[model samples]
Target: MHLKDIIWMGGLLTVLSFPVSATEIEWPVYGGDNLHQRHSKLTQITKNNVSGLVEAWEFDTGINATFQATPVVQDGVMYVSLPFNDVVALDAASGKQLWRYEHDLDEDYPICCGPANRGVAVSNGMVFTGTIDARLIALDAKTGEKRWDNRVVGDNTGIREEVSRLDDSELGSVSGTSGAGINMAPMIYQDTVIIGITGVGYGLHLDATDSDSPLGAVVGIAGKYGRRGFMAGYDMKTGKQKWQFDTIKSKNWEGDFVTKTADGVELPRDIAKERASLEKYSDAWRYGGASAWSTPVIDPYTGILHFGTGNPSPQMEGSSRPGDNLYSSSLLALDANSGDYRWHYQQVPHDSWGYDVASPPVLFEITIKGKPIPAIGQAGKTGWFYVHDRRNGKFLYKSEAFVPQKNMFELPTSEGTIIYPGVMGGANWSPVSVDARRRLVFIAAIHWPVEYKLHQQPARNGEAAIRYSSMSPLNTPEKHGLLTAIDLDNGEIVWQVKTENPLIGGVLSTASGLVFTGEGRGELMAFDADSGEKRWSGKTEAGVNAPPITYSINGKQHIAVAVGGNRLFGFKTGQKIKVWRLP
Candidate 1:
């Protein structure tokens, strides 16, 4: 049956005073709902019996690439997106393949990162995905047939022009890198499907540091490169462009040039030089690079959608772009239908260290001063959990540092400077899960510090000389994973669990008092939600580097995660989706 028909029937039955079906415990949206909580209400697999959990079935897509997609299930049917933007449907109860749709991608499609498609969004009996080539396509949910495709961001000619203008030495294997393309999962709100691009603000990266590292430093070649990144809405039925919100603003993109963060943390900045060069680079927003990579959460009641933005262009070198670079490294709220800006909170202004707001915002109610206030919270790369008023973007409070912090906002030196919670951050692109009942938030974080160094070269002709910077991964004695639980009440850490390697994917919370997450070491485990105790663990062939999701069929709950590890982080690669249930 179609999704609209199911919703219609369910609403009708509810109005007719009939009981709702218990089998309707489905994960219909990407974060399990419009709020992006990533929490399930199923209690069939409680903490007491979770130790008996065993693999019920495993499905391999036969594509041995980095698999980061999270499966969305509805009515016992599961849908997942494979790397290179392929879509597949499966029987959630049996792991049987239903249908598959492979994308006919352009041979010359350019991407700054690996071939990873986060997942797909389903609504109105159709599934939607954004391609690496910067296009959005809709498919028949049951048959996996292409309905329509829309090029949200056009041709590579602009990207090629930007690359051609760069110096040969500055190219650094970046000629093949296109500025913008979608790596995030699409979300359907009302009748519009929303998605955004990544790699727009990415600097030229090379294997100069070490081949073992998944990603290297962003070599600074200062010039106008990378198109302005945006989050756009499309007609779900026809794949038509609806409304677009650019992360880079045109006028007044530069704020008051504050030297400190919104929370009053002092940041190091060369204010005199920046203000002196403001006019020369006033048009930098035209080529600004605040890529939107995470999925947005919508408050259905308020009709407002909230998401985060990445760093500015010519990353790690702010000489060309001055002022706060408004909107980059920010949490933005927009009107869901019209895409009009409601409010924004800039976490790091004129971010020179590549500290973008990579994690998605989670919405919930937080009580303050004996009054319940509607709030939104996001785990930041700066190692802080920021809580804000959902209605107006007001700073309510911030949690203590979830990961270690050292030499934050320090200038890159020619002699090399070490910084904790480096560019990869206290929390990377991984999403965090929240338990609203207990007012606890869970984060899978990394503690890998980075070394920042400056690079300078003479101008070739009468042109301006280039000044850039490079960030290399430091071989520190302590590089590990931190699974932290923070109580939202007083911003105190409840408990923290350290892993052998850094955590990347995300977390899932259940009503049965269990927190489920994966590690880079290929272990999928369950923890006591309140106490942060490792209750049970299971091993996969490769790293379980994607988010864990839970859904039930025939009153039986299943725990599932993707085991296609991330190659960028040097994790073992595999192509399997393993589902577990209490046996």
Candidate 2:
């Protein structure tokens, strides 16, 4: 795909906007402009003085929780999310809180993960967030005052009553024992904001688990209205549902698709196509699991959306869904408007490793084998870095060593499946940044094998949850973390650096020619963006998972991170914001 020769955006008709300059300040949105190019054009904080950069101003966001939120900076105000569902706007230069807005927590909300927000989206003059308690809130960027709060996922009221209705089975599913909610950042499209859901596909009902709730879905929401998914678009100004594009439309796809004709919602056409595609298909919705998990990168050039899919449930038991899964554990490039499939590449087809290829796919132009290929790269939880020809989903060699495994858990079909990048994922949600000038892709990964299991314990509260969970196979060299810089041209490893903790968040590479990543132990470090050599390391006072953002405020460039002790980050922990700048 190339640049948009036709630059007409139907959604943002009124807002006069400037074209995204090739090297304008990014940190524009969560994943760095729908293309998910975490790559930045800022180079002022390069290698030479990265070490010389020290703590300038520090402000703590909160405690040991899932701080997946990366701060989004625009104008001169920096917007970020705190431990609970709190939103904070701070002076870019002072690190002093300008305003703080909090989302009420659901006493019984099931958090598959923790109380961490992935990040915020800034468009117009507002910041957007899908909060922990299942609410979609908008706050004025300048004041941190609530503009509107819409329950995006679940209602917090009477959550305790809801909890009573659940048991071991139902509770497990809600806890991400199967997959509750772990979406990255929201994508801002025109006047509408886009976000995806990840609730382990099957909706776990009160009495029992149906094993088919349709957790994975990509929805178009209104930045103005605080509306939920695509079946409806909210008015950005009024916070009202404007239109709805329910991908599944009706809930009973496993059977009948009953819909309110008046609402413009109907049975999903994709379900019908899938039903027709199946050799012995009965129902598609009852068990359609190809959830659009991560945020999709937009190809402004082709009007296409790119994203990764998660594992099909009854996940450990692959025998459940059966045929070549259309999208699970796959990389998909689809038409943004119709949700029509363009081209797809399943990293692990009929996946069994629980290796859901759900990381935000980074978009960039790479020179591969002498060809300038615009590509999409993702480091799946299965432990592999996948780089594909973004134009056609074609394969490029993976940089990891190919070891012969017993194939003890699952097998591939006659079609040759590429080897080396197992799903624990050479690099997962911890995002990677590319240095376009240097021609390198920086990635952090957990090199381990996950033991597979479908069901281990007796059903509880009528739900089946993930059993015997652990991530031991890949965290090898025992307690080591790795930062790999790949030569984009040949898909070869240029530099391999290992740390003590699993790379929890991501690496931030700047025009200053440095890469910044936080340790699982809560310390943030800087490396030569091109050489992978350590420049400096200091504790953040907490385990860090949120990606760090560097911005120039009043002529001074500073780096700041949210701190907390994440059991997953594994680093020595503390809670307090840490900041460093050039003295």
Segments in model 2 whose C-alpha atoms lie over 4 Å from true places? 1-26, 62-64, 153-182, 201-235, 238-287, 290-293, 367-371, 401-424, 453-479, 572-574
Please give, for residues 1-583, the per-residue lDDT of candidate 2 as tens digits: 2222344477654434454353245356766555655666555676766767777777765554556677777776777776566778877777788888866776665554445567777877888777545566777877777888775544411111122222233124332222344355666656666555555442222122322221221111101111112222344555544433322213322322122111121311334444454445333323445445555678877766777766554443333243444455667776655555577776654444556666678877877456678777776665556778888888764545211133433333223233223444556667777777787877766543433222234466667542332111333455356787887666677887887665667777776677888876667888887677898887666677667777666566778776665543344445566667778
- Model 2 residue 291 lDDT? 48
Decoy 2 TM-score against native: 0.74
Worst 10 residues of 1 by lDDT: 14-23
Over 461-515, each residue of candidate 1 has an lDDT whose tens digit, in order, gives 6766656677777666688889999997778999999988888898999878999
Query: Which candidate comes out best when scored by lDDT?
Result: 1
Global fold similarity of model 1 (TM-score): 0.92
lDDT at residue 176 of model 1 (Cα atoms): 27
